[model samples]
Target: MKPKRLYYWLMLAVGISGIGGLTYWDFYQVRIAAVTRNQRWVKSVSELLHSEQASMARWIEKFSIESATFRDIANSRRDVAALILIDNRNRQAQRWVRPGLRLEPLDPRVSVLQLRALETQKTTMGPVLIIQAKPYFTVARPLGKNRALIVFLDAARAWGLLREEASLWHIRASIYDFEKNPMFSSFDPVIPAGALAQTLDRARSKETSGIVRLPRRLSWKWLITFHFDPASDWIFLITQHTTWAYAPVIFFVICMAGILLIARIPFMALVGTRREETAQALAQFAGRVDSYIRGRDAMLQDPPSGIKELFPIAATARWLIPQWKRAEAFPRDLALERKLLSLLVESLPEGILFFNAQGGVQLSNELGRVFLSLEQEGREARMVSGVQVPRGFLEPYLEPVFTGAQPNLGKEVDVAWADGKHLYRLWVERVEAEQDKTGGFIVVVRDITFRKQWDYVQEQVLSGITHDLRGPLSAVLGYLDLMKRQLGDGAAAKVLEYLRMAREAGVRLSQMVTDILDVVRFEQGKIDLVIEVIPVVDVFQRIKNTFGVIAEQKKVNLKLAVLGDSNMTASGDRKLLDRVLDNLVGNAVKFTPPEGSITVTVRSENGRVLFDVVDTGRGIPREAQSRIFDKFQQVRPGDRSAGYGLGLAVAKFIIEAHKGEIRVESEVGIGSRFAFWIPIRPPDHRAAGKSDALVNMDPNEVVFPPPAA
Candidate 1:
């Protein structure tokens, strides 16, 4: 055989051995899993069978006990018939019959046998019909009241299930008399005389059910017999077999075996063969090397007598030398490439810096050095324009590099800088390197002085225009107000009404200007809040009185209820909270139907004080609630009802400023409730008002009455 052919044969043998071993292992594992699942299924079936047995026992007991427990119904035969005792006299002691069927007389021989059996008091009886042809189990229980009640079970259906579905089990269940003679059996089998006598004696002696296993036709089958005393001398036998109960488990095991054969074995074989082939190849290569070395030494020891032998040794060495050389160069080549890339990265422009995870710079390029030179008083790089920057100048940026938290700007931050000649736009980004090394950012600083100048000019012009109109608007409103007060009646008053309308228009314009200013302040983080603890009752009273006159004119019932008024104070910005209350109450009045009610409530719950304004009005639609607190947003189309759509937005800001929360609840076509909470203890920036009770109401408006159950 060729050497290569011999080597392949050995490898095949090794692979086959491995495949055989793996097949055994896999088969064992699959078998174990199948057995476990089957065992679990069997256990579950056993438990279910046990539970059913107990239930049947209870059912039988309940049936037997009904004779005396419901004696009136038994006697009247309204829902049940009376209990009867068939004694040795061949006559019933008591009989309650339906119209058709009559009780049968007991034959003397049978009666004597039955009476003797009754003295033993076995749990099972036979040939007793619950309803004729429904030949069922009969349990005779002796009532403490001296009555014998018999209960018949319709177990024929259950037996049918066992036969049809539980085909796996071979069951032969029967009811036997206390004398050990079979009264009823599914298929009569010869019973061992000793076992039969023992079962009968057990039934007669035990107060509860008894169980046993029996061998029939040389097959080990389960004979589980349980009984309940339905009447004096009768017991019901409800027997089941293990195979019948766990038939599904058997089927599952068969299916699992098929699956393992079709899938698991092939996969295990493939894996084992590959592993064995690899191991055999490695072992063969080593063996060949050892042989070659020994051959070489032998030749050297005695001057290799032929040229052909030496040629083979030389050829093997030549092959091994090249493989060793290639293996040696692989790591060197990788190291050389990495070094080259590092050199190239050190020489880029545009502030080429790598950011660490904590937003600090780890490396920077030439342009980065130049930028840093301008930003910090003294900062430098290891290489500046291909030359080393001094240590003194590089020290400042090194702090961020070492800490890995701040980016070396390599440039000055010119944001809000007043210099006209220099405007630098700075960009910062974060990146992740391999092995958990975080690089902060590649910062680029581009000068945009000319563009910045244009932006500055635009902002100045806008601010100027907003500022210039305020004085003239104030004068217009003041003059219109004075004119309306003077001209109270007649045609001049009508002319003054038009002037008043113009003044109101001017006031709205002024408020819009203020909102624009507030927006600017908010964006700049310059908005300041004046917080205070205020009586919510007072705030509500002011709005109610102010709108009360308007409400009277419109004939709307404006009801106010300050429940728990003795504890109505809340800690917050008084003015801001007032604005929130005003906006909600105003919206309520605006949307309310004529003569509808607007109710304001103040109460305390948990730790916070709550203010609620409920309105029987045209409630807000579901779609509008989410956007109601946005600036310049209004639910009313076309900005109707004297609102600039800034009320809720402003209220939201003020409430948030006080660290309070607000929520609105409403259903379309139903009313709405706007509720908010204010903390009892004012925040760090204290405002001078106590979290205490408010003044009593005008009494004309709704007041808090004593609570009732």
Candidate 2:
């Protein structure tokens, strides 16, 4: 084998070993994570056991000869089902049975719960027993002088306590006796005693806590985390599916394996014997070909090669020199052209960087050098551009083009660099000399930090100006209304007509200001949704009442339809929904010409509420439907004065804030149908005002859900 083969084998082995190590480490971490998650509940149960043991010991000390002691025990300990006390002489007894339980007293001499504790004179907990459909167990300790105290504990209560903690951690918890008998479980059907013992048997013998797998016959192989508490003399087990622990790591392994295979394919091709064998055979036959072709003196005494199969190669080589020289011959001034090209590339304001097929920098302008921080300053273009682009700087932006996954210059990628002190917009153009073998990329970088900051400041300025206009606009409308009301029926016909015109102009201007302010807020994510339950039909009725007069003035037919339970309710910002409905219905009224028909439809479907506003006027053009909801977009761009072109955009924002979507389907000559859907039960969240009350996100950056498939 060649040295290359050995080297490749060693690389392959190393890659496989690394992959194996990564997979093993991931699994180990997953196991530890699972153990950690289970530890929380296990610790809780252990604490409960310790507290209960201590409480029982204290209760025995706190017990009194008074009649109130039984009542006190009942109130203090819900787990106590019964309490028995034998007098010092064993002849006298005082017993208290918890309400709702009955058990005949046995001779203290024959009572097994006390027998062992009496002999040892120590406190001990005994085996479990069933009483009146509830599990019970005993805590026994000897009093002075042949007397004993036995308290019957309600195991059901203990189980209930465990259930709460187990539910909190979303895992099943149980306790087993030293003999592996199941006593208490948070869920049912509880793990069988035999199964519990079998699972515990799989655990490491000396380990107090470890992960164990259940038998395949009993399950799809679930895993359990068992913890033995020596102080309580009980084994606690937290059970969860194995998928919980292994799924993420298993997925990671699969992804890593695919990447490794892709990386190794080229190496395998390079190390293959086919290319080497073909090269060696050609070399043996054409041994003298290079010396004979390059030197005129060497060909006079001997054959160009010793082998017989090289006449065609010998002819081609003899003719190759003149052809090669002719192909490179050019009449242009090469040095001057090079000087001009360098000057032109270096004079550009933007940065230009050239990268070869292997992702090594081939050349760059002085600006590109500065952009990449290769040097603080440079006057000349970099000729020996041997450095690589910073890792991850270009991969996200250019890898798709290199792999043919994306077309060249299809998208612009803007990235923040230097801890966000600077931002750059980058474009990549692929340069290919042929379909295969030769390719490179020309990356253009434009600094846009100042432009971005200017846009932000402009938005702030516009927002302030638009907001200030609202007050004056409101005052103008208020005075106009007051004047018209006071001058009612007394003003001349021409005067009334002029006043109406002024009021109409004021109303239109006021609406424009309001829309401008609203759009700014929505884009900046400053508008908070006032989420509440909304009556869908009621909102439709109000729109009908308001727009019915407008439709009448235009001689258009206005109608309303309630589908699928008119009483259906939706969860969202009631005011916002009203705004959305107003936009759709108002647009229908405005655009519908004389004698046209408009219908407002409301319905509930599949746990969501749907609204559709259909109009029979000149419909939205089909080509413009896609971006009808975009800011400042309109179907009739030629008619800019019709409105500010913000109604649909504002409507879309409101619907999206409710986690809903709005869309339009239109045919140019036919009518248009605008539809939107919002979930009937929106998720529980703070109102969209602030993180302290609503969402935690960069308020300046408005993030919308991806378009539906």
Candidate 3:
């Protein structure tokens, strides 16, 4: 416990102990004085009774055989109820009665009294006797041989006198016989007979006068000082109520409690003043420390104040000020470095953000807040400003990085606004605080809106150029073919061959122009699709028929195989589907050498129809695979006779517009397999806007089989 609290309790305990000791001593003295006074009163009453008995005995002796004199003597003392002179023969010879005395005819009581007086041969006092329901006591004296005088004392008159004496002392008196019956009482309250009897029995065995307690219902109790008379076999009890007896003690206790309460005020006031001073000192020191932390100057030259115990703490705080200032030197440099880095990041065109492991934004530049769509001014403005980006886009990607599950973290992902007005490309890089432990990620974003618009414009220009050239190229090829036919073997063989070469070149040029037009049209989403269910076997048969003659002329074996429910069908425009197969098969036939084989396979997989064009040829290089399906891109670019490289690109657009996907799997020395899948139920064309649908597609869905090893 603290010293202050311990002292407070100690003072309280001492105060209570002193009050209790003093109250007990005072109550004990009052009780002793009361008991002593009661004993003296009882002794004086006993002495007075003895003197009255002696006087009565002398009067009887002097008035012997004088009836008038006996009457006069009995009348003179009201304490005497009657005078009876009995013969030795057990008979009442004469009876002198007071005027108000209702004496019954003397019977065996007189005989009993005479016998007791003769046995003792002196004055004898009888036990309290009842006559006509009133209590009386007899005093017997032997007058001469064979005769005795008996004095009957009225117990009621004696009780009246005792009551007056008890009132003066504030006590109640009761007289009980040896049989434990109450013969006289100073008051009318019921006495507990059993308890009185027990008390009398104890008093007889012990001293003549002592104290006893009697209990009553309702928590009432009485303190009784009792005196026992062996001569008369009676108990005289003086009782005082316990409540009155303990009144002084109660008063002392209440006064002491008040005194202790009053004394505590000044002590508490002193302690409170001391505490307030100490608190003020501590608060002032805390303010100084706060100022130092905030980079403000604070003076700590003052000496320690307040209580002695708090002095050491105040001094320690004063000593620490200089050390704290010195410790800030390195952190100042770190702060400068951090500021420079932040400025650099903010100056970049791209948006940058730093996130902690739990996906909360720790730092972000101005562009980052704009990209995230966060508040420009608020508590959240210091970090990433947006509400949606952190939870919707960033956290999903960052979780795998923080858990050590993703070793490669740099990835480019697209984020689009809700209204689709702006789009950003985010380059995310996971940064590690320790080896194999990720701290956070750095996100850099760039707005690619203008670049996308430029690409679209370039496609439109190419489409227009291709559309304009196709008509003239077709007419030139036709005119040349007609001139060759008209010459018909009459002209020179060299001339005929040159004309044939020109016609063939013009025809190839026209085909290239047509392919370019198709690519542009597909890119612009202008190609209308006639979607219907087309059987898989029928599509495969059509592909073989279209390429069978070319394959035979090239001396390459071409075949078609149907797998897994040959009766299955795909949903798409039949012409578009046939054109898709024609482009893939033509590419295969052009690349495959003589004695090589080409196979087209159709199968049902994952609720879609899958088509595969496999060929044994000089395979494409790994570096060229990614862009092989792009417009005007070719794997063997130097070969002029390879025609325009729009075949695969056109095929991809047609497939994707139908909500399908395409991929190429090839090895440098081995063959290539080009595959694509179209859903059995194509999605609504209008809802599948070209850019949004392509952006949302999962790249993992476009998988290829591994090389046959």
- Candidate 1 residues 493-523, lDDT tens each? 5697788689878977898777655544443
Misplaced by over 4 Å in model 3 are 1-391, 394-451, 488-492, 549-559, 593-597, 636-642, 686-689, 698-709
Model 1, CA-based lDDT: 0.54
lDDT of each: 0.54, 0.68, 0.72
lDDT (Cα, tens digit) per residue for candidate 2, span 238-273? 777667666656766786677667667766787575
What TM-score does structure 3 among the candidates reach? Answer: 0.39
lDDT of 3 by residue, 1-709 (tens): 7676676678777777887888888878877877788878877766665565566566555654544667676666667778777785675478777676676666465678788888877877665577776777677888667887788877675555666877887788877766666676777644576766777888778568776656657225667778887656667888777787787778877877786786678678877987898788767767766775565756543434444665575578767766776786769988988999988988988888887765567888998867555422332322222222344344444444444443223333555568575545545556678785667767777776676677678778878888888888878888887898899889998999899789877877787787877777776667788888898878877776788888999999998877767688889989888888888888899999999998887777667777888899999986577568767788888786665678788888888888887777777877898888888886577643255555455544434332222
* Per-candidate clashes, comma-separated: 20, 0, 2
Q: Output the worst ten-in-a-row residue range by lDDT, candidate 3.
A: 379-388
**What would the TM-score be for candidate 2 when compared with the true structure?**
0.35
The prediction achieving the highest TM-score against the true structure is: 3
Task: Please give me the total number of clashing residue pairs in predicted model 3.
Answer: 2
After superposition on all CA atoms, what RMSD does each candidate show versus the true structure? 27.6, 33.8, 18.6
Ranking of candidates on TM-score, top first: 3, 2, 1
